[model samples]
Target: MKMKFEFQFPDIGEGIHEGVITKWLVKEGDMIKEGDSVAEVETDKVTTEIPSPKTGKIIELKASNGDTIHVGDVFVVIDTEGSAEEVSSEDKKDTLAEKKEIVEEENAGVVGEVISSSEVIAPSDEKEGNSASENVAGKALATPVARKLAKDLGVDINKVVGSGPNGRVMKEDIIKASKQPSEAEHKEVLDETVKTTVDAKEEKIIVEEEKIERIPLTRIRKTISQKMTQSRFTIPHTTAMDEIDVTQLYEFRKKYKDSLKEEEINLTFMPFIIKATISVLKKMPEFNATLDEENDELILKKFYHIGIATDTDRGLMVPVIRDADRLSIIELAKKVDEVSNSAKNNQIELKDLKGSSFTITNYGSIGGYYGIPIINYPESAILGVGRIVQKPVVKDDEIVKAWILPLSLSYDHRIIDGASGARFLNMMRELLENPEMLLLKA
Candidate 1:
C-alpha cells in the first residue's frame, strides 16, 4: 500500500511567521530523496532552502512560486511508495479523498485551504480511460467568458483543448478551436472576438501601466523599511556632529596597515573606531541602554555586542560582533572581517544579526560625510563614521595639514539628553584623535 505524506513548511528561523516561495527546486512527479532541497523560501530574516522530510515521488506541489506560505501550511504532497504503476479509478478517488482529509486536518486554523492540484499524476497505462475530463464528469473547467464565446461560435466547449491552470478552458483556446476546418462557419465570429480580445488586452496594458518601471522590494529590503520606519517614529532622535584631527592616528594606522596584512588580516579604521566607541560606551552607560516603555526604566547592557552596519548587494545588514569589549585590536580586526564577509555573502547566522548593544555604521568608506544615522531601536545610540579628509589646522600656532575625521552620533533623546550625546561623541573624538589611548581599553 502506498502512503501519502503532506510536507508542511516548518519554522525555519527565529520569529519567522511566513515566507514566500522564491523557487521550486523539484516539481510534481519528480522523485526526491530525504534531505534533498525542494524549494527556496525567502523569509524576512533570510532566504533558505527547504529540504524534503521523506524520500518519495512528488505527487503534487501544494504551493506555487511567489505564493506566501505560512507556518504549518502544507507545501508539497509525496507518495512514499515511489511506484509509477497506475491504481484503479476507484483507488485513485479514495487516495485523493484521503489526502484531502489529511491536508485539512493538518492545516486547520492555518491561512488558506489546502486545495489539491487538478493536474493528474503521470505514468498511467490507460489513455482515454484515465482522462481528466472523464474523471471530472466531462466538464471542461473554463471562465464564464470562455463558455460564452464557445456557445457564440457553435464550438463544443468540452471538446476544445484547455491551456490554463487545472486545464481550464480560456478564450484563446475557444478562438483557436473555432479556426479549425470543421468550424469553418464560425470564422467570421471568431475574427471579431479575436479583434476585441487584442484591443482589450492592449488597452488594459496601457491603462494599468505607468511610464516609470516598478520593482518589488525584496524580503530584506522590506524588513529594513519597516524597521527604519519604526525606529524613526518611536525614538526621539538627536544628532551631534563633530570633526576630529586624527593626523597622528592616520600616520599610526598607515605605519602598521600593511604589516597586519602579512597575517592575512585586512585592517581598517572601523576596528579602531569600534574599540574607541566601546570605551566611551562604558563611561556613558545611558548611551548603551534601552528604554523599557512598559516598566518605565532604562535597561543598561553590561556586555558589549557591537553591530557593524555593512552594505551588500541585497541591502544594508548589521552583523554583530559578540563580546566586543573583550577582544584585542588584532582580534577585533579579524572578527570584523569575519562577520562583515559573512554578512556580505549572506552566510551570517540569524543570531549574529541580533543582540547588539550599539550599532556603528561606516558610511565613510563609501564616501559619505556626516549623516544623521538612526538609532537601531531598543539600542540607545548609533555612531556614524564619515570620510577622513586632510585639511589645514593650527598646530603650535602654525597652520599645517592634518587628517580630519568627521563623526555623527545620533542618540535616543528620551533617555540621553543633548548634552550627554555631545559628551559621548567628544570622548570618542578624544580617543580616536590619540590612537595610543585606544590601547588602554583594548
Candidate 2:
C-alpha cells in the first residue's frame, strides 16, 4: 500500500510570509531517502534547501520552479510504504548556514488538502517530472546567486550554456551571455521590432499600443521597499556631516600589516572604525540604543553589537557582529570577512541579521563621499563612512597634506537632539582621527 506525504511550504521564520521557488532538487519517481534535499527556496534574506521529510519516492510537485509560494501552501508530495500521517514538528526546517533555527510557528507542520493533479501547475504534474534535467521545465540549473544575476541582467539563463561543474550554470556564464548582444545589434533588433509593428499597423486597423517593459519585483526587493519606506516615513531623521583626518590610521594598518598576517587576518580600516565606534558608543550610550515608542522610554543596551551594511547582488544586508565590544580589532576583522562573505553568498544566518543595536554603512570602498543613510529602524542612529582621500589641510597655521575620511551620521531626531547628534559625531570624529583614543577606557 502506498501512503501519501504532503510537503507544505511552512514559514521559513524571521517573519517571512513568502518565498520564490528557485530550484527543485527532486521530481516524481526519482528519489528514495529521508532528509534528502528536495528543493531550494529563496527568501528576501537567504536561500534555503527544502529537505525531504521521509524516506520515499516523490509522487507530485505542487509548485513550479520560479513560482512565488506562500507559507502553508503545499509545495510537494511523496509516496511512502507506511500509512499516511500529518506533518509533524520535524516537517519544516529553517536552515541558515551552520546555524539552524527551528520554525517555532504554531502548527507549522503540514496541514493541507491532498494536492490533486489538476490543482498545481508544476512541471512534474504533466510529464511526471521523471527526467532529471527536464524536470524543472525551462528553468536553468544555476546557483541562487547565478539565477539572481541572470534575472538582474535580463539574460536568459536557460539559453546560456553552463560552464560550471556537472553541467551547472554560473554567474559568469550569464554575464558573458548578456554581453553577447552589442549596442549596435540591440539597436538593430529594436529597429526591426519598430518596423514590424508599423507594417502590421498599416496592414490592419491601427490600434494604439504603448511598448513598455515591466519587471516583477523579487521578494528581496519588495521587502527592501517596504522597510525603507517605513523607516523614512515613521522615523524623524536628522543628519550630521563631518570629515576626519585618517593619516595615522592609514599608517597604523600598514604598520601592523606584517605582524597580523602571521595571525592570518587582514588589516582593514573598518576594524579601526568599528573599534572607534565601540569606544564612542561606550562613552555616549545613547548612540547605541533603541527607541521604545509605546512605553515612551529609551531601551538602552548594555552590550555593543554592530551591524555592518554589505551590498550584495540580491540586496543590501546588514549582518550583525554580536558583542563587538569584547572582540579585538583583529578578531573583528576576521568576523567582518566571515559575515560579509556569507551575506554576499546568501549563506548568512537570519540570527546574524538580527539584534543590531547600532549600524554602520561604509560605502567608502565604492568611492562615495557621503550619503544620508536611513536609520535602520528601532535603532536610534546609523553612521556612514565615505571615501578616504588625500587633501590639503591647515596644521598649526601651516599647509599640510592629510588623508581625510568623510562621515555622515543620521539619527532619530525625536530621541536625539541636533546638539547631542553633533556631540556624537564629534566624539566619533575625535576617536577616529586619533586612533589611539580608542585605547583610553574612559
Candidate 3:
C-alpha cells in the first residue's frame, strides 16, 4: 500500500500571507526524504528554503518556479512508493483529478510555471474522506517554517505536541524538540552507501556563453511596489533641509573609541544620531505616531522604537529597535550593530522588523550627502541623515571651518501638519548641534 501526502505552502514569516517560488530543488519522479530541501520561496522580507515533510517519491508538482502561491495552497504531492508513470495513469482515470488539473494549470504559470502529466495519481475517494483522521493525527498539515525548523533542530514533528491554533506545529515546538536527546537518535538512519561521490578525474571544465532571462516580479515584490506607489500618491511630501554642527560629537566619539573598542563595541556615528533622535522625539511626539485608518485615529506613541533602514544586496530591509527610549547610548549602539549585521547577512527574523514608531535612514555612511526618503508606510515620518562635510563658515567677521551634517525629514501631512513637521526637524537640529544634550539624556 502506498501513502500519498500533499504539502501546502507554509507561512514563511510573521504576517506573511504568500510567497513566490524562486526555484524547485526536486522535479517530479525524484525521490526525496523527510528533511530534504524541496524549494526556495521568496517572501516580502526574506528568501527561505522550503523542506520536504515526508519521505517519498515526488509524484506531482502543483506550482512551478516563479509562481506566487498563497499560504495553505497545495504545492507538491508525494507517493510513499511508486513510479511517476504509475501515478500519472492513476490520475487520468479519476474525474476529480481532471478538473483539479485544469484549474491548477491555469493558475500555475500566471505567477509561475506548472509541470503536469497524465502519470500523476489522484487521491482515492476513501483517502479524501479520511482527511479528518489525518488532521487529528497532525499528519495533514504543517507550515513551511515549522517543517524547516523541525528538520534543522532534528525534531520529530509527528510526535511533538503542537501549541499553535488548530494543533499546528510552530517554531517553538521545534525549539522545544531540540532540547530532547531522542531528536538526534535517528541521525545515522539514512543509507550512507547510497551517497554518490563526485569523480574529479572525469570532471571537465565547460564554459557556456552567459545568457540573461528576465523573470517577472514575485508576489511579494509586486505587493511592495503597489504599496510604495500608493504611499507616493497619497502623501504630499516636502523635505526640510538643515545642517547640524557635529564637530563636538565627532571629538567625543574619538575620545571614547578606544574604550568602546576594548569592550567589543563598534562605536559609529549612528548611536549619536539615535540618541539625539530619541531626545527630539520626546519633544515632538507627533513624529512618532501613526494614522490608524480603522479607528479614524491619530495614534500618538509616547514610547520610541526607531527603525534603521539597512540596504541589502537583494533590496531594502528595516529592522526596528524595540524600546529605543529605554536603552542607553551604548546599548542602542550595540542593538543597531547587531540588527544591521543580521540584515546584511539575511539572518534577521520576522519579528525584528515589526512595530516601529518612526524610521531613520543613514545614507551618509555610503557617501550620500542628501536624500528625500520615502515614509515607511503607516509611520508618520522618516529622517534621512547625510554625510558630514568640512565647510567654511563665518564666525563674527572671520571664516572658520565647521563640520556640517545635512538632514532631511519627510512626514505625512494627514497625521502631522507642516508646522509640527518643521518643529520636529528643528528639535532634531538642536540635539545634533549640541552633542552634550545626548550625553545628558543618556
On TM-score, the leading prediction is: 1
Stretches off by above 4 angstroms in model 1 are: 82-210
Which residue pairs in model 2 clash with each other? none
Tens digit of per-residue lDDT, candidate 2, span 183-296: 677667453332111121112222245543334565666656666776888899999999998898888788998898898898888988888888878877888888888888
How much RMSD separates candidate 3 from the native structure?
17.5
TM-score per candidate, in order?
0.73, 0.71, 0.68
lDDT of 3 at 166: 39
RMSD of 2: 13.2
Question: Which candidate wins on lDDT?
Answer: 1
Q: Clash number for every model?
A: 0, 0, 9
C-alpha lDDT score of every prediction, in listed order: 0.74, 0.71, 0.68
lDDT of 1 at 119: 29
For candidate 3, the TM-score is 0.68
> What residue runs in model 3 are displaced by over 4 Å at the alpha carbon?
27-31, 81-215, 293-296
Off by over 4 Å in 2: 10-17, 81-211
Superposition error at 182 for model 1 (Å): 42
